[model samples]
Target: METNEILRNQIFEIIKNQLKHNNPPETKITLDRLRAQGFNDSQARQMIGQCISVEIYQIMKTNEPYNNARYIENLQKLPKEPFE
Candidate 1:
């Protein structure tokens, strides 16, 4: 697979795992909230993936550990887009 496709698949797998395990629980909740607000499963998941990307970027750029709080905050702001 191409590099971008590989990364997207990796992110997709992370999302599937998050939903499967409900590690943060917020992930599933965010999925439901987005659905209720009229986003389809794919759209909602893509939005969630964007949040994950932001978290990943922060981790790589700052060399800090994952921040669940920031991730959750980004999720709560859905469709508005995640900047952090």
Candidate 2:
């Protein structure tokens, strides 16, 4: 459990850093990048999902005049595994 938590944190940090460096903060992260970072397929997928969830949360917090419809729409735009 401890190891899993540590790995998850590392994956999250990598994804976050990549996003931060992008000119427009890409909506999708490639599996190739995650694999190059040493994550297996399942781990990569989990990390991508976590990244999307975090982005959704950030959007919810930062966007003004929050609209439920827009929030859901934005979430639907987030990258999904196997396709990203």
Candidate 3:
């Protein structure tokens, strides 16, 4: 697979793994949902991975809250150009 495709799949897997104990991965909010929330396609996907990274970062450090403010902060750290 192309590098971008591999990265997309990796992000999907990470999102899936994060949802493992909650609901089925297929049922979890995804990049598509993020798009529905007004983010463009690339933004949505980048935000998806960023969200997961935020969750994992919090977990590894401590059980930090994954609230909207925190998410927005993480989103801001993403490159203006998607997936660079």
* Clash statistics: count for each candidate: 0, 0, 0
Please, what are the lDDT tens digits per residue for candidate 3 over residues 1-84?
A: 899788668877766665575333422455445566687876666666766555556766777665555554444554343221
The 0-to-1 C-alpha lDDT of every candidate, in the order given, reads 0.94, 0.52, 0.57
TM-score of 1: 0.96
Question: What are the per-residue Cα lDDT tens digits for candidate 2 across 1-84?
Answer: 698687667756655665577522332345556566687867765656565455455667777443445433443443342221
Off by over 4 Å in 2: 1-29, 64-84
Among residues 3 or more apart in sequence or in different chains, the pairs in candidate 3 whose N, CA or C atoms overlap within 3 Å are none
Alpha carbon deviation, residue 73, candidate 3 (Å): 13
Predicted candidate 1 versus true structure: per-residue lDDT over 1-84, tens digit per residue = 899999888898999999999988999999999999999999999999999999999999999999999999998999889998
Most accurate candidate by TM-score: 1
TM-score of model 3 relative to the true fold?
A: 0.38
Q: Which regions of candidate 3 fall more than 4 Å away from where they truly are?
A: 1-10, 16-30, 36-40, 63-84
Q: RMSD in angstroms, candidate 1?
A: 0.7
How much lDDT does candidate 2 score? Answer: 0.52
Q: Is candidate 2 or candidate 3 better by lDDT?
A: 3
TM-score of each: 0.96, 0.36, 0.38
lDDT of 1 at 79: 83
